[model samples]
Target: MPATTVLRPRSRTLIIAATVPLALAALLADDVRVRRQLDAVPPDPTSSRTDSTTLVPASS
Candidate 1:
C-alpha cells in the first residue's frame, strides 16, 4: 500500500511516485481558483456607498 510505503523514508522513488498525484491535484486546484478569480466581475466605481478607501482614478 502506498500509505505505508510512502512513510518509509529510505525508498525515495516510492515516496515521490505516491506524492505526485497530491502535487498535481494541488496545482490543478490553484489553476482553477485563479481562472475563477479572473472571470469574476469588477466592482462598480459609481456606487453611492461612499467609502474613501475605494478611490476613483483621475484621467490626469
Candidate 2:
C-alpha cells in the first residue's frame, strides 16, 4: 500500500513567506512604471496660464 503525504503547517508558512515579497515587488514595479509615464508627459501651458482674451469686459 502507498503512503499518502500530508502538507505540514511549516510548509504553508514558507510558501506564504516566499510569495508575499514577490507580490509586493510586482506592485511596486508597476507603480514606478506608471509614475515614469506620467512624469514623461508635458504639462499644458495654455491651461495653466490665464489669458486676457478669456476675460469678459463688464458693461457700465
Candidate 3:
C-alpha cells in the first residue's frame, strides 16, 4: 500500500477555493427552489387537522 501524503498548502487552497463557492451556490439554489415551491402551493384547510383515532373498545 502507498503511504498517505497530506495535501500541500497550494493544492489545499485551490481545492477549497474551487469547492466552497460551488457548495454555497448549490445551497442558495436549493433554498430558492424550496421557497418557490412553498409559494406556489395553495394552503389546504383539511391538512390543518387530524381525525385519526387509535382507541379499540372492548366488544360487548
Candidate 4:
C-alpha cells in the first residue's frame, strides 16, 4: 500500500491562496443574484400569519 503523501505547508498555502478568492467571489456573486431575485419578488400579505391556532374538539 502506498503511504499517504504528506503535503508541504507551502503547497497548502498555495492551495488556500488559490481557492479562497474564488470562493469569496462566488459567494459575492450569489449574494448579488439573490438580492436581484428578492427585489423581483412582490411582498405577500398573508405570509406572516399561520392557521395553527385553529383547533378541533377531541372525539369522546
Quantify all predictions' global Cα lDDT against the true fold. Answer: 0.76, 0.80, 0.80, 0.81
In candidate 2, the residue pairs with backbone N, CA or C atoms under 3 Å apart (3 or more residues apart, or in different chains) clash, namely none
lDDT for 23 (candidate 3)? 100
Candidate scoring better on TM-score of 2 and 3:
3
Compose the digit string of candidate 4's lDDT tens values, residues 6-58: 77899999999999999999999999998888767766677653443446667
Models 1 onward score TM values of 0.49, 0.62, 0.65, 0.63
Compared with the true structure, model 4 gives a TM-score of 0.63
lDDT of 2 by residue, 8-34 (tens): 899989999999999999999999998
Model 2 lDDT, residue 5, Cα: 75
Residue 52's lDDT within candidate 2 is 29
lDDT tens digits, residue span 1-60, model 3: 356888889999999999999999999999999888876877666764343233456699
**Arrange candidates by TM-score, highest first: which order?**
3, 4, 2, 1
Candidate 1 lDDT at 29 equals 100
Q: Judging by TM-score against the true structure, name the best candidate.
A: 3
For residues 1-60, what per-residue lDDT tens digits would candidate 1 score against the true structure?
A: 555554556677788888999999999999999878865846558876465356787798
Q: Which 10-residue window in model 4 sums to the lowest lDDT?
A: 47-56
